[model samples]
Target: MAEQKEDTQRERFKAFSHVFDEGTLRAIHKESSIGSFEALQSPIKIGKEANVFTAVKGDELRCVKVYRIAANFKKMYEYMASDPRYTGLKRNKMSIIYTWAIKEYRNLLRAREAGVKVPKPIHVFKNVLVMEFIGNKEPAPQLNNSSPSNPEKFCETLISNVRTLYQKAKLVHADLSAFNILNHNERPVIIDLSHAVDLRYPNANQMLERDIRIMCEYFKKMGVKKDYKEEVERIIAK
Candidate 1:
């Protein structure tokens, strides 16, 4: 039975091997060996840079994000190079990808410490990141797909999270939008923190303003009133 199970697992990995490189496969196997997850189930989201999948860890579910080796690393380096944390980073493609994964892990930890709602990071190795699954039976829908029942309250709570993320965490989510936020149990859960950067980044304020503007405009369509500039000021206020 154990041999059969191993064969099945190997086949499962083989199925997805076409999408990942040998190094990524080894990393995933390493994660499995460490009991991070038993097996990867199905892909949840496929973005330009990373692919997210649902994985089974013991009895509960977890999320596994794999950064694509063939992704636009040049664009990633361009974005990451500005962050103070990665100031002297080299131009190596694989290094940038690995660093990007590490950045997201750190960002999630910082945001959680700041009391912001996000997926709890489990572990990060190479280009693989395991995190808590934010959902009931299935994964939660994005804010754009599932509008909150109470738009005003939800908007307020989301803004508060953003404020805490900026003030307490001292980070700016460079790419914030309804598409990357999950509407979990009428609450907002921010995701895609790979682009979030330290406040010292040259374009942090600009990115923060853009984030607030996008969120405010999204909530406005749902009848939530908010001035983007005032919101930005409130977030940055001491």
Candidate 2:
């Protein structure tokens, strides 16, 4: 039984190895050997730009997001160039994508420190990021896909998280929306922090307001009674 299990594990690892480039495979193997994860379980999401997978680490499960090297590098470059922190960055496509992954990891750490409900970042290498999984057996569904039973309370909680992220974390989630939020057991778990930026960024305030507006409009469409502009002002006031 032990030998059979070992063979099955080897076969699974071999299959996953084919999905990544040689360099990436080496990095993944290094991480696994160092105890980051035991094995790749399955893919959770395959977005146009990145692929998110679930991995096992001892008794725990984690999420691994891998950015595709052949993805839209031009768009990644454009986005990175706009961020004040990455200003004057080199024009290397792979470097830009790798930096983007690092940014997401750092942003999630900042958000977690601020008490915002987000996946805890585990490790990052090149264009791959590992984070705490949000669900038990399966990944959590996005808020857009799973509406909360209490829309009012849920919206309030989400707004509070946004405010905490901005005021305490000094970061703005430029792409905040229902699609990026995970409804984990009726609570909001924000994900996809790749576009989050520091408050010192030139357009940080504008981005914050836009995020608040998006959240308010989404809740309003779902029958929540609230003033979006007022909510934005209140959050910034703090």
Candidate 3:
């Protein structure tokens, strides 16, 4: 039984390695030992610096975001350096990528606890971050592609989520927009939190305004009347 289990794990690792690097394979194996997931099913997204995969844990589905070890991380290093939470982090490529994953995992946990609609983080090992998959059998589409049945309600819900993400999570996404928000059954699920920063970050206010501006620009095209200043106040209101 032990040999059989070992063989299965080896096969799983081998299959995963076809697309991932040795370091990423090692990271995923470490996470699997903690039961983060049984096997990686398939790649669901190919983002700028990371790839998202669907994994199975028993009968449940989970998301595994793996930062591309070879990705150009200079932008990330600069952005991450500004976040007070990541002060003193090494500026090396690998260190920056791993820290980005860690940041996303921590941000997701904080957002979830604060009642923002976000994927619940499951585990973090090296550059791999696992979280509860936010979708039905297949993953949800971005708001840009998945137009809601009721645009007004969708806009309202999105604003509420942003407000919660700010006032409760005490963080700014710094990159929030229709592109990063999944439209799951008309509800919004915010993703791509690696760039989020605590409000105490020196650029937090600017980041918040930028996020709101992006959202407003996207939603305005959808015919939602928006007052940028009013919306910003609404999100930060006491």
Task: Estimate, for each residue in 1-238, the C-alpha lDDT of model 3 and write its tens digit.
Answer: 9788767987977876777888898888888778999888888987768889999899999999998987778988888887788889897888888888899999999999999999999999889999999889899999888988877788888889888988899989988888899999988899989889999889888888888888878878879888877888888889
Q: TM-score for each prediction?
A: 0.96, 0.92, 0.95
For model 1, residues 1-238, the per-residue Cα lDDT tens digits are 9788767777878878977889999999888878899899889988778999999987999999999888898988999888878888989989999999999999999999999999999999999999999999799999989999999999999989999999999999889999889999999999999999999999899999999999999989988889999999999998
Please give the lDDT score at residue 119 for candidate 1: 97
* Residue-pair clashes, model 1: 0
Lowest summed lDDT across 10 adjacent residues in model 2 is found at 4-13
Off by over 4 Å in 3: none
Q: Considering lDDT, where higher is better, how would the candidates rank from best to worst?
A: 1, 3, 2
lDDT of each: 0.92, 0.86, 0.88
Clash count in backbone of candidate 3: 0
Q: For residue 10, what is the lDDT in candidate 1?
A: 78
Candidate 1 deviant stretches above 4 angstroms: 1-8
Per residue, candidate 2 scores C-alpha lDDT tens digits across 76-180 of: 788778778889778888788888889999999999999999999999988878899998587889999988999999999999999899899988999999999
The TM-score ranking, best first, is: 1, 3, 2
- Provide the lDDT at 37 for model 3: 93
Best by lDDT: 1
